[model samples]
Target: MKTSDEPIVIEECYAISQEKVWRSITDVREMRLWFFATINSFVPEIGFKTEFLVKVEDRNYTHCWEVLEVVPNEKITYTWSYAEYSGDAFVTFELSKKENQTRLKLSLTVIEDFPSDIPEFSRESCIAGWNYFLGERLKEYLEG
Candidate 1:
C-alpha cells in the first residue's frame, strides 16, 4: 500500500466530449448519478461548499468539500476532508479532449496526515474507493 505522503493519481479516457465529462463532474444532478448520490448541491464556481454524510458499516463519515478552483470544462479542484477527521486533502479533476474522447485525470493530495489506524483512512482504501467511483461507477454511468 502506498503512503499518504505520495499523491494518488489516476487517469482514464472516455468516449465522450470534454463538456459532457465536465458536466458529469461539476453539475450536481449529473454528479449525483455517478459520484455521490447524497450530494445535496454542487457548483463549479470557486468557494462553493457542500457537505454530506456517507455511512459505511456503522461508521459515518461527514464529507466536507469546498471548490477551490475551476476552469470551465477543462479542470476543477476542490478540498476533500471529513468533519470527524483531522486530515485535509485536495482532489483535482482535469479533463482534456482527444478527438472524440475525453481524458480525465484525478489526483488526490493529502496535506495533513490522517489517523493511520483507521481502515477507511488507509491509502489502499482511498485508492479502491476512487477506482470504484471513477473507474467503475463513473465509467458505467457514462458508457451505459
Candidate 2:
C-alpha cells in the first residue's frame, strides 16, 4: 500500500492510571521493557535526542528520535527517523484519563515520503507496529 497523506493514528485504552501510562512511555527503563529493548536511553524533555540500532535480519535500521514537545503526563511529541533511510516522521503520544482507565493515542506523521521499496516503511507495517506496541505489548506490560 502507498503511504497515506494523513497521519496514522492508533488509540488504545488501558485499565491503568494516566501517571503509569505516562511513565511507561517517558521513562527509558519502562520503555525498554515494552517499546524498544535496544533503546539505550530516552528523555521526555523537549530537545532531547536518542538513537538506537535495530537489526532486522541482515539489515540494520538506526532509529533516531528527538523530543519536540512534552506536556508532562498528558502528551509527548518527538521526531522519528532512520539514519539509513531518506525519510522523516513525527510521533506523538497523548494520554488522557478516562474514568479509572487511561486512553493512549499514538500519532505518526510522515514529513517526507519513505522509500517505496522498503516494506517496513509501508503504511500497513507502521499501523501494525503501533497496534502491537500499544494494544498488545504495552497493555500486557502495564496490566499483566
Candidate 3:
C-alpha cells in the first residue's frame, strides 16, 4: 500500500549512449520491443497522446497517455491514466550521460488514487513492473 503522495522511483545505469537510450524510450518501435508491446504510437513531444489496452485477468485497462514535457535526449514526462479507472499519474524519465554510460532515472507520481481492490494497481506491483521493464527488459534489449 502506497500513499498517493509517494512517488515510485527507479534508477538504472546502462552502458550505452544517451541517444540510444532515449530512442528506446521515445520511439514506439523500440518501446514495443521492451516496454509495452501493445503501444500503438508514442511521440516524445508535448501534447502528443496515445492509448492502448492492457488485459489483466478478466479486466481491461485502457491506458491513456499524453506527453507533458520533452527535452530531447535528456528528459520526457507523460501524463498516464486509465480510461476505465479513477487514477492519474505522471511518468518521467530522465537521462544523464556519464562518460561512456548513461544513467536513467524513472519516476512515477500518483496524482489520484487507483482502486485498492485491484491487486495489479498496488504499489508493490507498480514497482515490480517498472523494475522489470527498466532493470531487466530494457537492459537486455540494449546490451544484447
Candidate 4:
C-alpha cells in the first residue's frame, strides 16, 4: 500500500443553498447525476456500504465505500478502497452556509498504500479526478 502524509483537499463555493449542495453529495440519486456514473446506490447513514466498478482505459476498478460518519447537512465521512487493490482512504464532504451560497469542502486522505504501478492510483490522478467530479461536474449540475 502507498502511504501519504497529506490529504487532498478540494473546495468550492457554489451559488446554491447548503441544503441543495448537501443533498447532491449525500443523496444516492443526486450523486448519480454528478458524483459517479457507476454508483449503484448510496446511503448517508453510518455503516452503509456500497461498491461499483469503473473502467479506465482497459483497467477495471471496483470502488468500495463504507460510510463512517454523518452530521446531517453538515458533514459526511466514508472509507474508500478498491476491491482488488492495496490502498485504503477516507473521503469527507463538508458543507457550510456562506450567506446565500454554500461552501463545499472535499477531502481525501490515504490510509494505506495503493498499487504504485497503476497510473490511475497516483495522487495526481486522484486529485484530478476529484476536481473533475466536485469542481466541474458538481458546479455545472448545481449552477445549470
RMSD of each: 1.6, 1.3, 1.2, 1.2
Assess each prediction's global lDDT (C-alpha) against the native. 0.89, 0.91, 0.92, 0.89
Task: Give Cα distance to truth, residue 98, candidate 1, Å.
Answer: 2.7
- lDDT for 88 in candidate 4 is 93
Global lDDT for candidate 1? 0.89
Off by over 4 Å in 1: 1-4
TM-score, ranked from best to worst:
2, 3, 4, 1
- Candidate 3 collision pairs: none
Candidate 1 lDDT score at position 22: 89
Query: By lDDT, is 1 or 2 better?
Result: 2
Residue 61's C-alpha lDDT in candidate 3? 89
Candidate 4 stretches greater than 4 Å from native: none
Per-residue lDDT of 36-59 in model 1, one digit per residue for the tens?
889999989999999999998988
What TM-score would every model get versus the actual structure? Answer: 0.95, 0.96, 0.95, 0.95
Candidate 3 accuracy as lDDT: 0.92
Q: Write the per-residue lDDT of candidate 3 for residues 3-111, one digit (tens) a residue.
A: 4458999999999999999999999999999988999999898999999998988999889999999999999999888999888889999999877799999999988
Candidate 4: tens digits of C-alpha lDDT, residues 1-144: 256458889999999888889899988899989888889999999999999999888888899999999999899999999898888999999999888889999988888988889998888888899889878999999997
Clashing pairs in 4: 1-113, 2-113, 2-114
